[model samples]
Target: MTTDAGQYDDQGEVPLAGYAALASVLATGVGAYALVARSRGVRLPERLPPWDVVLLGVATYKTSRLLTRDKVTSFVRAPFTRRTGHGEANEVLDEPRGTGVRRAVGDLLCCPFCTSAWAATALMCSYTASPRLTRMVCGGLGAVTVADWLQYAWTWTQRTAGQ
Candidate 1:
């Protein structure tokens, strides 16, 4: 049952339909990948190497942060979200706007943890289609991730030394 606004209930407004649509899109994407891989005679790897897995994990983390939090990428999320404030490390804080699908998308776009699933899926698909290119891309992202950590460490060290 919905509230008078037709968007809320006892548990408040939950975008069930919107979430389902997003899930459907994800499923469709995976299914398409499988079909394309099979049709192109691509062989699935028996198992991913531990190093490759680590690379993908770092890449996914960085990619997710880039898409969801970076100030430069806010334009992509602006349509579905409203800027509320600035966040740490050159990130923007945004609140999901609108209702239903739009809000669902905004929620996904604003959350690094949520977006990481999509990033990992895309990276895995790329790896399946072209391991060499995927590895290069993952390597670059992984490098950036390390560099970011180092930058933070440097700042922290300076602050500590000053104190």
Candidate 2:
């Protein structure tokens, strides 16, 4: 286990300081956006179509990184072969409540945002890696972008319809 923190462990290497900085910048941007939205009276809601997912995803992903870094990552017994941890070994694992809706929104935001960022870098290797991999990533991104568009369209339609 190697840590950018200058150590090695069985858990492998911790992410570089670059990931930490990137996460921090993302967190700040999301927080600032939320604050600005609130100031404008654009009340951010917590639900299926919540724009808040951007912030939550950033924070949650960051938290996951921190938790994993601490080497306190927990594991549970698997079913089929009595194996533990994630993957097909634990097919019956339950997603925490709110995770679905939250991740739905995350999928609707995070992927697209990330896709753009990685594509912009050109070195992220996610965009032009392989046709199949690129398609999967872009497809996932399109899902979120489409959902976001549809959400805005629906809201606009409702407002115009006096809803």
Candidate 3:
């Protein structure tokens, strides 16, 4: 339903799925906070890299792709989605099971944009808790992120060059 702000809002009885998503986000935040606290206690490096935000953004992008998409999630989305096809791109099947916590988690898992937030939180907290390992992982993912963009750009160039 549309709210007074002219934005989308839930109508009728609020779905538990929405509640589940909200709770999950809050819980994640609390967990991140705890990690930060522990990092401080352990005298870990709290300062971020020079381009840490940008790095995390790239890492989140790669992580989202790993979580969502077809072939990637096919191996992991069981009990939530039916696994079908022969590991092809469009083989992963999503089975919507009405409104509930499971549905909420399924939705979150199916959308990279949604999952990116969770990934970013985890990466950010990890950076504080263990900068060395976090940087290694994020750096590698960031490299892949750049490679992905370059591949897209290359394809676009090839197509446009023909014109």
Scored by lDDT, the top model is 1
TM-score rank order: 1, 3, 2
Quote each prediction's TM-score: 0.92, 0.28, 0.69
Which ranges in model 1 have alpha carbons more than 4 Å from their true place? 1-11
Q: Please list the C-alpha lDDT of all candidates, in the order they appear.
A: 0.91, 0.39, 0.70
Instruction: Give the range where candidate 2 is weakest over 10 consecutive residues by summed lDDT.
Output: 74-83
Tell how far residue 74 is off in model 1, in angstroms. Answer: 0.7
Question: lDDT per residue, candidate 2, 36-124, as tens digits?
Answer: 65676654223322332343344344333322222223231111112123432112222211233333323223233443442333312
Q: How accurate is candidate 3 locally (lDDT)?
A: 0.70
Q: Residue 94 of model 1: what lDDT?
A: 88
Task: Name the lDDT value of residue 97 in candidate 1.
Answer: 88
Candidate 3 per-residue lDDT, tens place, 1-163, comes to 3565533355533346565776777697867788768766955465655787788888998898877765746657665554434422233445434466666666766667878988887887777677779889989999977887788799889989999
